[model samples]
Target: MEVSMFGGLVLVMVLVVVVVPALLVGLVLWLVSRSTSDDGGAPARAARRHELLVSSVAVLAAVVCTVVLLAQPVAWPGWASAPGVLQAITPFSVALVLCVVRAVGEQTWPRPRGEVRSAPLARRTIWSLGGARLRIVLVTAAALAVALVVFGATADPTGRAFATNPVTLPDGSVVSGASGPYPGWPYGLPMLLGLALAVAATFVALGSITRRPPLHGVPARHDDAVRATSAARLLGAVQLCLGVGLGGALAVGGAAIQSRGQNLLLDELPTHGLVAVGGGVALLGIAVVVASGIAGLLAAWPRAARHAGAPAATGAPA
Candidate 1:
């Protein structure tokens, strides 16, 4: 009871002190990203700088991890077995994960100052009330249906009790029972689908922001840029979400498969066998997302940099 109590306290503390702050910060940045244009201000410049920093950090971490592994080989769960070596390399893994997350957040970086000013920065209209909500409902319902089907279908025929205590294998190369007794597919499919729904909702929300009819009292050039920005932002966000979902599926699903290996042959599992395919999907998503963001910025570039680009008049139809 005491151990459980202590664990609960630790979890609560972690959530309050770490997770909540991270989430809040992410939310702020996301809103800012959607609102701010790439006009070389401190925020825009910072956004540009962040991309380089993340990429450089990722590459540097990979190189360092490779060097460390070569210097002192360790088992797969090195953190548990050879803590000293893994401790050094863990930073790199963490940095890589952070870089991936940051890239996803940055996918919402806005277009040119001129285009964004003409549009409503934080306004909602019929599109959000009608189209976006409809999209969300349809997508979420479909995902839930699919999740239920997969969950029920993947149930173990023999009803094997899941291992409560995970242990390292004798070979020390793999660990099993890192997850619950449920089949990997049952758990992973739902998670992947949930992530997908969130992505789809975000795309729809961004689309609603671009609901500027042709008669919107803005210049044609600015209107076109606004539409382009909306498309670019939505595409970038979609790619980011897809990549993250695929990556999460592979990681969690692979771990679950390995956990079940005491009874099941994970090597023969299609999900485990097709890791290369999963990686390709993730990489493709990341590439497309990053490309869209960069392209959006370039496309929104105005001929004049110092110009305070806004709508011709206040209260214009955004």
Candidate 2:
């Protein structure tokens, strides 16, 4: 459905970006908490409560965003049109179900209280919420990057040029602009780049789960880290699907513009602008993912670096 510029922005920010991660993170946390909370102890109960809270917040946010998305009309033509309110209903329902599973699971999981082995960086990263939710944040950030890239690649460039059904435009109008999914070389570049970013994120999530290189702070041998990474990978895969799939749709717009005898008036700068904006969004995603991955990797490696700095057991202390 074609959505207006403002409508597009809201849909991208709320549905694709915010709601998806919230659902994923809340669900994962709830599941993990449930698995560990076997003893009807205070901690287990508390964890369940926290899970409920996260689920509630996520559901609330998704609902609000969906309402906003449906209420708003898309200003642009093919690129931006008001979507059916029902469009968001399915995802919302899915998110709600995930929340329910997590909340229920939290009540029955085994709870063990051993000395929490500290990861120096993980400690610092989530001093407020703790390490359990750190992976959630990472996954959410990655998803955000994915959405931003998708936005840049698919956004209507030449403003309202695409709004009026092109077939209805005056005769002899040289329509040389692109439209929905897989527009041209312009959109292809972002699609590929965004796809690459999503793949890289998947690799990083895997490494984090396995506690591989760059995930040093993530407790390489810890079960929690593994579980967290698994959740993160799932989220990343979703992000990849959305980014690549949306990009393909945008590229189609470019393909439509391939008519040789179409009106050149359609060759306005706004069309190029929309393409550029979309590309820029993908570029931003690339930057964010690369930077975050580097930061995470560095943070994860501090312990090894410290050990490397130390003298051997047989050597005298510095």
Error of 1 at 210 (Å): 4.1
Give per-residue CA lDDT, model 1, range 243-279, as digits (tens): 3233232332333334554333453422333345334
Worst 10 residues of 2 by lDDT: 297-306
> Model 1: clashing residue pairs?
177-259
Candidate 2 residue lDDT tens string, 1-318: 433432353356445444564455556555655565433245324433543454345345545644553554433235322232223222333233333333343334333343433333332121221243335444553553454354344445632123323442355554334343323233334333544454444334333333212221222223232233333333433333343244323333333332211333344323434445445544554444344333322222101112333322111111
TM-score for each prediction? 0.33, 0.32
lDDT of each: 0.36, 0.36
Global lDDT of model 1: 0.36
Cα error, candidate 1, residue 96 (Å):
24
Give the C-alpha miss distance for residue 191 in model 1, angstroms.
4.0
